[model samples]
Target: MSIFISKEAKDKAQGYWFGLLIPLLAGWGVSTFSMAALMSRDGPVSEMTYVDYFFITGWISGGLVVHPLCAWWVLLRAKIVGNAPCIKGAYMSIKLYILWIFFLLSMTIISFIWGE
Candidate 1:
């Protein structure tokens, strides 16, 4: 097989990788740092402890709690707009929100099983 890769394929791969990587890292960083801070007294905890628990809780909270709240806010905004023309952005947001809900639900189930 040829080793050459097209620029479009390379870009698509990078986009997929970064899209997945950035969210995971963002969730991990937010969860880990926040947990560490709360768990600490003198100062922010420097080392990660109970990493798996933090990651699981972070993803769970982000997907279930945060995502729904954001979706609500979007819906509220749409309501305020009151019969305005359909915005392209809204369709994209709705798709992303649905995907996130499914992903979060799966993650929740996995975490529950794993926890047991």
Candidate 2:
């Protein structure tokens, strides 16, 4: 019935969770919100399939958000290239995930409420 984890364990878990979840969600969320925006503004798109949306969002999210953070984490946190506090990096990633999720949910709600 123990539920508490050590600080380092929590950080590692957070880091792994960030690696597992955020990239996929960020890509999908960005794509979905962007598609919603495009449809709302342009009114019924004939071009662009789901695959296109996926690829574009994957590229944007991975390139902009995930990859850079991964690089930094691998390099600095894991000591692959630099020296830095590992837990801090993990905490930062968690914060980023929270902000991104909040923004994504907010945009999705707005789209649902106001989109046509």
Leading candidate by lDDT:
2
TM-score of each: 0.36, 0.37
Cα lDDT tens digits for candidate 1, 1-116: 53438866665554444433444444446656656655653534565458545654764576445544544454455457542222223444456667867897899999999995
lDDT of 2 by residue, 21-108 (tens): 5544554566566556555553245676786566567555653566446534443544553323444454555566677668988999
In the predicted model 1, the residue pairs found to clash are none
Model 1 clash tally, residue pairs: 0
lDDT of predicted model 2? 0.57
Global lDDT of model 1? 0.53
For all candidates in order, the CA lDDT equals 0.53, 0.57
Model 1 Cα RMSD, 1 decimal: 10.2
Q: Which parts of model 2 have CA positions greater than 4 angstroms off?
A: 42-116
Shift of residue 60 alpha carbon in model 2, Å = 9.7
Provide the lDDT at 42 for model 2: 39
